[model samples]
Target chain A: MSAPPLPRTSAEPLVPVLAIVGVGLIGGSFAAAVRQSGLVTRIVGAGRQGGTLARAQALGLIDEIVSLQQAAQTADLILIAAPVGATTEILATLQPSLRPETIVTDAGSTKADVVTAARQVLGDQVGQFIPGHPIAGAEATGPEAADAQLFQGRSVVLTPLAENSNASKALLTRLWEACGARVVCMEPDTHDTVLASVSHVPHLLSSIYMWQVATAQDSDLRMALAGTGFRDFTRISAGSAEVWRDIFLSNRPAVLAELQEVKAALARAEQALIDGDGAALEDFLERAALARRLWGSRSGLA
Target chain B: MSAPPLPRTSAEPLVPVLAIVGVGLIGGSFAAAVRQSGLVTRIVGAGRQGGTLARAQALGLIDEIVSLQQAAQTADLILIAAPVGATTEILATLQPSLRPETIVTDAGSTKADVVTAARQVLGDQVGQFIPGHPIAGAEATGPEAADAQLFQGRSVVLTPLAENSNASKALLTRLWEACGARVVCMEPDTHDTVLASVSHVPHLLSSIYMWQVATAQDSDLRMALAGTGFRDFTRISAGSAEVWRDIFLSNRPAVLAELQEVKAALARAEQALIDGDGAALEDFLERAALARRLWGSRSGLA
Candidate 1:
């Protein structure tokens, strides 16, 4: 545990012994990817679900399953790879046992809340926390869905604290790059705002749309007629409620702002339809279609 | 064309020659599938875009490209494959030259309005018009996107007129079956209502979400970080504006009803978030996840 923290590059053993606080898809995938890259010598997973922890170890996503206390005290690096809402409690539990040189980071969807939780729980040791959000996941969940290439070419955003040492930030960046991700730095507020607009709003809307279809009086008939369009549009509606509930509540303000924006835009289309304004509706649709196609082609998607 | 003139089922040349008015993805795919099945001797395409019509012929989706007038005058079956809003005008122009043995049908997304258009333009000839919705399409369009197997194993809902002779209905059913579709009969109004809840609403919501993202102040950054979730959620927003505008206008009342239903469902989630009710939000999310997962497996999509 030197002051400069080894070499902070690919030459260094970034995670010689790493500890992951949650053994779900995100945590397991992080463990799998870093281990595959030879950046981590061993990965210890700790979670409330002992069965899942054991399974993750069996699947080679982790080297061993340990208790939270043991994970907090021994690892060279700590990853709080749990839900955003769980940040506070986990940080509080680990507060008494944390070693200063052990770089602590997280893979939570919401950043501002995680920052607040770190400040409250870690006290003066908050500098150890460099909050991160990897914009990658599947509809599937758990350690069983973990993939070694999950982070390849994907974007991972890091919100660093002013108290965070330059060596620590650079080490985190190199570690993520070794895992095959493109790392970008941002303010926690900026991360939360952008994510709410692009990710959280779409997820909530998809769920709402699915609930509407499934609860309608003639729901069975309606679903029977649904096609590829409906399936793709509402695919995220199948994501885990346990994970999404925390994301929504933790990022409530930014999410609410984006939701309001969606409602206003939708109202314009609804108004155009009610008034039989074909021209207005067409213009609205044309603008959206053009934007989406431009982005789709730029992003190399069909 | 003629009052119960042609014999129904595959007993006769169900479609010795067929005319498709739009000749885009839907129309071209219909022609391609039927032609592959040997149910039609020749497929004639009519559209404002001569280039696309020519391309359809070159792709073998259509056997010939002709003027709307020529197609209306010569074909034994006139498939009004244009937009729903174009149905009335097309029928009005075709009414003067239709042969008595010709049986007319359409592939419009909305049934009730197409039935209205047929009634208004075809007069007593409306009995020959059977409205159909294929319930299959992709984000891509044009002749290049047309697939012969587009309708295979997919449901095709037919809303037949009271005036439809047993022969005409039987013939239409047999033709779709030939193209490998499972055809189900329904009332036009019922078809519209069911489609509104399952299909139309999802498309509109996706557009709204995309528009929301594209219009946000930091839209470029947000979209840059968008992952598979946003891509899947907004897939349908890339559909043709010109085509969707007509469907939205023609199916106004039903789409609006479903849109309202979505708003109500969304409001409940919004309330749960505002009240900081994790249990309520979790419950709301659980129902949608279960419903979507069930449907996904049933439909062979994950």
Candidate 2:
């Protein structure tokens, strides 16, 4: 069969057909945003469950529901938006049907593990896979929560492998920019480590904190008295458990290293409290407060 | 000098002259809210810094900037909204000029510590001090951030002393209600424990996390990659360092206990990660996610 080559640059209808696996918040939003940008003519969604794909289609996030094999064989690009734990299996399943011209990327929170999975499964075709993470999320999940504006003013990091072609990198960059995301490229290891500090470990700590509060003897009263501070502090704990679980396990080393640092920081604070050193405690708190305030102001967060 | 008795019911203009010491966010907002409720005829602001009091006055949160002694002598009610560490000094200053009928309350985050200070300084007049904790705050502080609707639909815990009269309790409850807060009564120790679990410990943990991230070797890259989740998780860390230092010290016992529990919870998570126990990790995450989601939905927080 003879097929026309897909466009390799920023042009209208950049993707003739785009496939999105696991049409949850990230996947569904990607489909919606790309469709709205007029970069993709058709979006085929695949997932472990049929209901999610159907919902994505109904919500206009996708043009059709298709099998992973069908998506791999037919689409110019396939985005695996499933949990990071499923990356290996998804890559294996798609490898057989993958077209050499198809450029596959993922929206996993961790990059190094995804890249390793792609290399192990795709072998010589690893160049087709670009590990990417969109630095945007919400407490809400699933197809119903997808929004076209979800990627607006958000950061999307791409960890391109050495085997990846320049054309594919340029095309993927252009496509994400079309969705209103600022795209940054970095090494997979660096991406994993940086994300571990900012995202993965924070999520782990928040979940741990929430678990402690929920399991306490007076959890009912504690919950009742919890105000905006607790609400915001624990907001990330309400994220998809399976997704976060995979992220933590996949980036275990970096996460553990970051967690150790956090423990050290807390121990210093504990020491200050135990010694009744008001000046030391104040100094510790003031440093964090000042840093947080500067970041909040610079980031335009109210 | 003899003065007429203050109204002890939910009547209009309940406070003829209200004094708000340390007119920062809490005190300034209280002044604005009470004045809007038509419960306070005039609000006198006092703080360590003249600029803050002047700003509060200019913002119309208070009618005048007066000394603590003057406020104690002239006001129907005095709200010591200064830092918990300053509670003893403020109460001591007010005790000498205190009018018998004047109701003294506070808006401290910790109740037991504030109550202890009030008892120490007010002596026989401890009954006049109704220890209260407003379960509301914002990352922003100062007079400029004052909002009249800040207390609307919020909780205000009152830990009335055994020496207190029913009339004083009734008047304080009525005044808080007029400011659009739901007043709940509890023991001072209970208030401290509950708030330590929900507020104090969480603030400490958030600050610790922020400090760790800010002081990391690749902090610039990590901060650049930080998104909404990090922003929300660390928002409380941006709160006034001096204010939080006082809270942590004042409620040291409860906060330390809660921090111990959090460390235990994190240790369990660390063990699961080390053992590569996906099942245990998933279970831990699922419980917290379910609890947080339920609370978020119930609290009408989107």
Candidate 3:
């Protein structure tokens, strides 16, 4: 529990034990990335569904599969990589077996609720819990869709709650770095707000937009004629429904505020069109285009 | 003028003269694409600004720069590729010199407006005017950005106003085909409505979304943290402001309708999130995701 002794030798010691719970796309990808790096001596995966755990091992994403208690007892690093809604129960189950020096982290999108759950379950042991989110995924779900390079060139934001220890935070940062992610530090609330604007709100907007198109009177014909523009605009709408549901629920206020802001902008555009104000429309489009170009250039995206 | 004699040869005869107006991206690209095919014996360009003609010829987008009257008098095929707002004025200038048998057409986004303009300016020669829109472009603009292959693998939608001559329609279709585009026919109103849904509305949404992000309190941080999701969502928002503004003005009604529908969907999502109705949120996301996947799968986008 005290400051951990430094490794005896200069050579980087292998990750003694890394446990990934709920080995789906994110978790499975995490295990795969770590295993491929050869930095971990052993990677163990635990999932409620036996099929998922079996599939993770079969895909060579993990060195072994174990129960929650077993993984907590053995792992120097415990990664709770499950759905946000499942985190509380998983934390409760693993708390009893967790050791004083064990470092725990999560890859959940919503952070405030998860941090609260960790504090409630582990109390003083919450110091070992470093909450993190890896902003990488695909339209596809399941362990079969996991890729070692999923996190490459992407960010993994860590929201270390007040109780989190510096040692635990540093170790978690190292793990994310080893997985080829750029680590960022942000408060949990800030993380939620930023994510609502960038990730969660975009997903919802895409879904809502697609729903509007799909429900059109001549949807079949429209879908038939839909090309690259429509395809890309609605691509994120195809993300996992359950995961998004939990995210929207957890981050409702921020999401709603963001949506209202977008709606106001849309209203202004609609009003300009109704008024036949070409100059106003032009100005709006020009401003928006300039902002988007600036964002794209800054983000290093085409 | 009554009935142009069909060429008596198996091979299609080269177009003796071609006139391209505007000399911007679309106009210049059309000239380049036509010249590259060697289907036209001579290509002439006309624009309000002399510099555009010089730039078009300098960039090899056309063989020669000519006066609007001269280009109109000499050309067998006259292609207008100016912004929708300029179509009316361009038609007025070219009408006095339009040869009786000239096959005239436009590459404007809005067909109904162009058709209206043709009816006013060309009168009896309205039959010679075909309204077309090429559904292909890059973010870049100007004559220098013109590409001969811009229309390759892209759809060129033609709206031949009621009572258009079959011969005129056939000639325009052939011209687009020669330029490497698949041509499709639709009513002017239908074309406008479909484009509003697939193109105009998406642009508005993307722009509005980007505007919202730009106005956020932590705009810089959010921009720095933005990933591919935000990039793709806002891709169209980064296009030419003037062009998009004209599109919004020209297709005002349809864009407004689509915006209203999207707003309703966003409102529903907002309500669901506010209520913390996880089931409703999941259902909305699931249906949207399913619809998108179905559309993507059918369109071969996946």
For lDDT, the strongest prediction is: 2
Share of native interface contacts present in candidate 3: 0.68
* Deviating ranges (above 4 Å) for candidate 3: A1-11, A49-51, B1-14, B35-38, B48-58
Best candidate, DockQ: 2
lDDT of 2 by residue, A1-302 (tens): 11235554446578899999999999998888888777888999988989888888888888889998999999999999999999999999999999999999999999888887888999999999988999999989999999888888889999888898887888888878778988988998999999998898889988999999999999999988899999999999999999999998999998998889989999999999988899999998999999999898787543
> Which of 2 and 3 is the better model by TM-score?
2
* Deviating ranges (above 4 Å) for candidate 2: A1-11, B1-12
TM-score of each predicted structure versus truth: 0.95, 0.96, 0.92
Worst 10 residues of 1 chain B by lDDT: B1-10
lDDT of 1 by residue, B1-302 (tens): 11244444444466889999888888988888888766688888887889999888888888788887888789988887777888888888888888777888888999988888789888888887788889889989898999888898889999888888788787788778778888988888999988888888888888877887888788889878988899999889999998889989888899998788888888999999999999999998999999999999998645
Interface RMSD of each: 0.9, 0.9, 1.5
CA lDDT scores, all candidates in order? 0.86, 0.89, 0.82
lDDT of 3 at A199: 84
Displacement of residue A10 (Cα, Å) in model 2 is 8.4
lDDT of 1 at A132: 94
DockQ for all candidate structures vs. native: 0.78, 0.80, 0.63
Q: How many backbone clashes does candidate 3 have?
A: 0
